[model samples]
Target: MNWVLLIIAGIFEVAFAACLGKAKETTGNEMISWYVGFLICLAISMYLLVKVTQELPIGTAYAVWTGIGAVGTVLVGIFVFKEPASFWRLFFLLTLITSIIGLKFVSN
Candidate 1:
């Protein structure tokens, strides 16, 4: 359950990052709306992270959280923002995903 919360928190981290990206591309009310969304997602992510850290090892949880955020944000960049999906970028992404899964397996 803690792991589930951790994953959700990481997903919110991705959402907040996406909101920031969208905010950068807009102006006026839409920009404000995106910023608001960023704040909300940020709060939820932080709350869940704090909640899960009580049960999970801090080092492992933090690494997995950032790992999920990094992997998810990169995919969002490639798909939603149409950023470069170069060979090396994808190669490293695969490795990051592998590491995240490995952490989950090795952790208690």
Candidate 2:
């Protein structure tokens, strides 16, 4: 259950990061709305992370959560945001994902 919350938190972290980028690209009212969404998503992400850390070790939880967020944010940047997708970026994203899975396997 804690892991589930952590994953959800990571997803929300991705959402907030994307919203932040979108907000930066917009102007005035649109930017304001996007910024608001980013804040809300960020709050939820942090809340869930707090929940996960209640039972999980802070070091492991934080590392896995951030790993998921980084990979997810990069994927969204590539797909929805249409940012550049260089070979090394994809390679490192896969490597991060592999490490995340490894963490899950080794963790109790």
Candidate 3:
């Protein structure tokens, strides 16, 4: 359950980051709304991440949270945001996931 929350925190972190990017790209009031949403989500994600860290090892929690966020952000950027889709990109993302799984055992 704690791991679940950590993963959620990671995902939200990715979302907020993407929103920040989009907000910067937009114009006027809509841009302000996006930045606001991004900031709020960022704060919540950090709070949840801190909660998970209290129970888990610092190294494990940080690695997993950041790893998930990186991979998830790339995925969302490619699929939902239509940034790009390529074999090389997918290959790297897979490598990241593999590394995270490896760290789970290695850190423990």
Candidate 4:
């Protein structure tokens, strides 16, 4: 249950981050929607993060949450924004994913 919450929070983190990126690209009325989306996702993500942290270790929970967010945001940046997709970047991304999984396995 908590794990599910954490995962959901992480997904929200991704959404908020993507919204931020899109907001930066927009202007006036176009930006408003992205900003609103960013705020909504940010709030939900934080709420879920706080809820999960009540039971999970803070360091572990934070790392995993940010890990998921980082991976998701990078993928979005790559696919949507067409950011750099060098071999090294992909390698490190995979490593981050592995570390996140390891943290989950080691936790209660």
Candidate 5:
């Protein structure tokens, strides 16, 4: 359950990052809307993270959260924002994913 909430929190982290990216590409009202979305997602993400940290190890939870955020944001950059998906980028992403999984397995 805690792990599930942690994953959701990480997803919100990704959402906030996506909102920031969108905000960068817009102006005026659109930019403000994206910023608002960012704030909302940020709040939810932090809330979930704090909740889960009560049960899960802080180091593991934080690494997994940030790992999910990093992986998700990079994928969003590639697919949604049309950023480069170079070989090295994908290679490192795979490594990050592996490390996250490894942490989950080693943790309670």
Candidate 6:
């Protein structure tokens, strides 16, 4: 289903973004692997996004994709990078998730 594709794309979007962050953190040329991984994931994510957009509303698809990416990136930044997960940041993340869900529901 298109909805399943949309969700999968969102997950891949988050994965590629997290890989990009990791690539930046790598000190040596080994980071190239992350770059490659990022690109591959990015391509797949975009493909799925375009497919979903063909059948769904742009606003809805984009919001869900971006929201999932944002939340997933913040979570990776906190857990993988040992970044602080402040209360305010989590609050806004929750807000973003809520808005994304609301948009999806309304659009459908």
lDDT of 6 by residue, 19-90 (tens): 898899895677999999999999999999999999999988988998888888899889998999999999
- Per-candidate TM-scores read 0.99, 0.97, 0.89, 0.97, 0.99, 0.94
Off by over 4 Å in 6: none
Instruction: Give the per-residue Cα lDDT of candidate 1 at 10.
Output: 100
Q: Considering summed lDDT, which 10 consecutive residues are worst modelled in model 5?
A: 50-59
RMSD of 3: 1.5
Q: Using lDDT as the measure, which candidate wins?
A: 5
User: Model 5: per-residue lDDT, tens digit, 1-108?
Assistant: 999999999999999999999999999999999999999999999999999999999999999999999999999999999999999999999999999999999999
lDDT of 5: 0.99
- lDDT assessment of candidate 1: 0.98
Say which prediction, candidate 2 or candidate 5, comes out ahead on lDDT.
5
Task: Write model 2 residue lDDT over 72-93, tens digit each, in one string.
Answer: 9999999989989999989988
Lowest lDDT sum, 10 consecutive residues, model 3, at 99-108
* lDDT minimum window of 10 residues, candidate 2: 86-95
lDDT of all the models against the reference?
0.98, 0.95, 0.88, 0.98, 0.99, 0.90
Q: What is the clash count of model 5?
A: 0
Model 4: pairs clashing at backbone N, Cα or C within 3 Å: none
lDDT measured at residue 97 in model 4 versus the true structure, 0 to 100: 100
The CA root-mean-square deviation of candidate 2, after full C-alpha superposition on the true structure, stands at 0.7
What lDDT is obtained when candidate 2 is compared to the true structure? Answer: 0.95
Is 5 or 6 the stronger prediction by TM-score? 5
For 1-108, candidate 1 gives per-residue lDDT tens digits of 999999999999999999999999999999999999999999999999999999999999999999999999999999999999999999999999999999999999
- Residue-level error in angstroms, candidate 4, position 23: 0.7
Model 1 TM-score (2 dp)? 0.99
